[model samples]
Target: MAMGMASSGRRRGNRTRRAAMAEINVTPLVDVMLVLLIIFMVTVTLPAVGVPIELPESRANPVEELPDQVNISVDNAGRIYLENDPVAPGGFADALATIRRNDGEQPVIVLRGDTGLDYGRVMAVMGELNRAGFKSISLVTDGSDTAP
Candidate 1:
């Protein structure tokens, strides 16, 4: 009987038993979530789409930015905008006059003209600004990489 029990124990030893895993391993899942989070964060900081315009490059020194400055943009389609707000072509002068009176002080005007726009269009806007009594006017352009 002892010899038979020893043989049964050997047979049982020959068969392997494995315990089933009860807990989930979340390390890979957490790593994937973190990578997705980083991708979103990087994309969020990129510039959003706005009025499409190609700016001409110039070797002129960059003008100092001021808090009391206003932007007047002209798109390639000849549409005029005041700080992203569309202004009617005929109402452009009136709008500037109103803004000038409300501010009480002459603010610097920054004109951003698209490269495809007519030269006369930009000059007309500038003339209107001058008529509105704004003396400080600056033309915005992309900086040239070449050394002056």
Candidate 2:
């Protein structure tokens, strides 16, 4: 009987029990999340979406600064750019709405219209911005135009 019991124990030992991976190995997941977070942080700090435009110069002081004010620029070719991305003339209202949503309440817009662009064109863009709930609008220009 003892030998029989010993053989049964051996049989049970031979059939090893296996368990599902119930325990989550958060170490790898956490490592990947941290790496992605670092990559995003580094990219956000750089001005990768810079729009090429020649800002008109002015003698007046600027009330708005970088990263705080939104840029709505018009190039010499009369193309409109919102935050470094081009937008169609007909889609101006839609773009402004999106910008207004992202900028939260009472956001300031800095218009960077080229000196060569038509005045009416810039005003039309401003009107669209105003319609999209932007009450404050600024024109960016070089300080050289201002009185020394």
Summed backbone clashes in each candidate are 0, 4
Each candidate's lDDT (Cα)? 0.79, 0.74
Q: Report the lDDT tens digits of candidate 1 across residue range 1-148.
A: 3555433232344574445677999999999999999999987743221556688889899887776688888999888888878898699987786674334767888888899999999889888888888888888888898865
| Over 4 Å off, model 2 | 1-49, 64-68, 100-104, 145-148
Which stretch of 10 consecutive residues in model 1 shows the poorest summed lDDT? 5-14
Please give, for residues 63-111, the per-residue lDDT of candidate 2 as tens digits.
6364556877789998888887899868888787776344355766888
Candidate 2 backbone overlaps, count = 4
In model 2, state the lDDT of residue 56. 74
Q: Which stretches of candidate 1 lie above 4 Å from their native place?
A: 1-50, 100-103
Residue 71 in model 2: shift from native, Å? 1.3
Pairs of residues clashing in candidate 1: none
